[model samples]
Target: MIRHLSSLIMDNVSNVKSFVLLGFNDTMNFRVPLFIITLLHYCVILFFNISLVLLIVLDESLHEPMYIFLSSFCINALYGSTGFYPKFLSDLLSSFHHISYEGCMLQAFIMYSFSSCDLSILAVMAFDRYLAICRPLHYHSFMTMRRLSQLVCLSWLTPFCIFSINIPITSRVKLCGINIQRVLCPDWLIVKLACPEVKSNLTLIVYIFHGFFIIWIYTHLIKTCMRSSEDRVKFMQTCVPHLTSLIIFLFVMVFQSIYGRFDSTDSSRIFQNLIAIELLTILPVMNPLIYGFKLTKIRNRILTSVYLNRK
Candidate 1:
């Protein structure tokens, strides 16, 4: 009897070649409108993020550490959005919402890394702001081009390496099911299908540390800014956008986590789908806009270029 049960479990594991995403099952009536709206949303994300990245790259004056970090942030947004939107749009138009095992894993990797990298980059940006505002005299000496390059590389590489380890660990788990409840495959959801015990907590710890560091830096920044009017103005101009982005990011993350953990069957499918895609949709569009409008140099450069081209 035990042997027979083991055989059945092995067969079940072998059968999970692809995962069926059930998030779109209830959207049959709205697929056309949904597709158009999602397409337009994706285009807007691409345009804004790409334009900001280009503006930073083409203009030499914007070559300071802050603008360089902003460019990296926008580029990461583009990377994250591409991983989600194309497959999502295709699934919207098709009857079947199936994703291959490889595709699902890749999507999860891209998304997980993207989020971790986002926090990492934000932490680096906070550090940059701390130096510029709190230690203006020593800012250039400390944040040399080489130091900036190392931080940028660490921001991108560290997350990618961490998630790279996670993907393989998840892949080795013996999955008992092939259906995912959300619009896209997240590693946690995939892990949920594991037939046996799966223990991993490194990513969570690393993320918590990143969050703590950012808050710590900002705490010092606020205290210093409060004492001086010049620092206060600089904080309003440069730091507000970072704070806004951080707030938006934290809000979306908390919302998604709550929904994912306590997701009730009675909840609306539309609401669940929105919650699932909120990170992809909102951050990609908002970050670039926030930075472009908030940063004086980038704002002035954009206006000057536009005015010149029209003439």
Candidate 2:
């Protein structure tokens, strides 16, 4: 019996060219319908993000530092959606499950790089709002077009730099015995699969350190906003979306870290399932809704733009 069981396990391993993505397996019967839904969501996010980005670029009235950073977020979302949903949509519609190892790595790199860039841009936006609200008198001079351009450039550049260093180092290592569990390879999960000697390549000490700086700056910005009684409404209105996104991101990261320490058992499988779907699929869908629609100004701008374009 023991020999038979061992043989069965080996046979299963040998025959398994790729692991089935049980991530969205819950929607098994509704794959086509779910694809349509994902398509609609992706279209809405793309339209709104591009519309806002165009509005900022074309309308002089919307060219402040706040709008500048908002446009950056839109661009990030545009690329981020492409990084994730294209493959997801394809997988759902045709039930295409096999992604080459290279393709999976590319997807992970693009997804993580875009997400990290979005975080940095949001931090910059928070700082912009902080200075504008806290120092109204000098807001214009301090956040001039040139300075805003520099900040935006830095925000975009920093993520690529970090990813360029970390992704190649981590992804180049072998994963001989590891099994990919989903339709996509998560960058961090790929790292975890690496053998011990090559593990240091995946240790993102610098990324973690910079992430803390972003959090610290954002914390100060939040405190500044809370302290100003006269500018309270405006501060909160501008800062709340950023604060919410940041909070949710940090919460997910914390949960992922804690869950990652557990044995690879049933509970870990549940955590993995939740993380794969929510973090990769749902988060991108929710991001534009949270940051764009919930804001009265952006909501109106998007509606007005769509109406005008239609006419």
Per-candidate TM-score against the hidden true structure: 0.94, 0.79
| Minimal lDDT window, size 10, model 2 | 13-22
lDDT of all predictions, in order shown? 0.89, 0.68
Candidate 2, residue 139: Cα displacement in angstroms equals 2.6
**Residue lDDT tens for model 2, 217-249:** 766666766777767787567777777777776
| Residue 274 Cα positional deviation in candidate 2, in Å, after optimal superposition | 3.9
Q: Pick the candidate with the highest lDDT.
A: 1
**lDDT per residue (tens digit) for residues 259-289 in model 1:** 7778787888778888888899899999998
The global Cα lDDT (0 to 1) of model 1 is 0.89
Q: What's the lDDT for candidate 2?
A: 0.68
Displacement of residue 82 (Cα, Å) in model 2 is 0.6
Q: In model 2, which runs have C-alpha deviations exceeding 4 angstroms?
A: 1-29, 94-96, 196-207, 222-227, 261-264, 267-271, 282-285, 293-296, 299-311
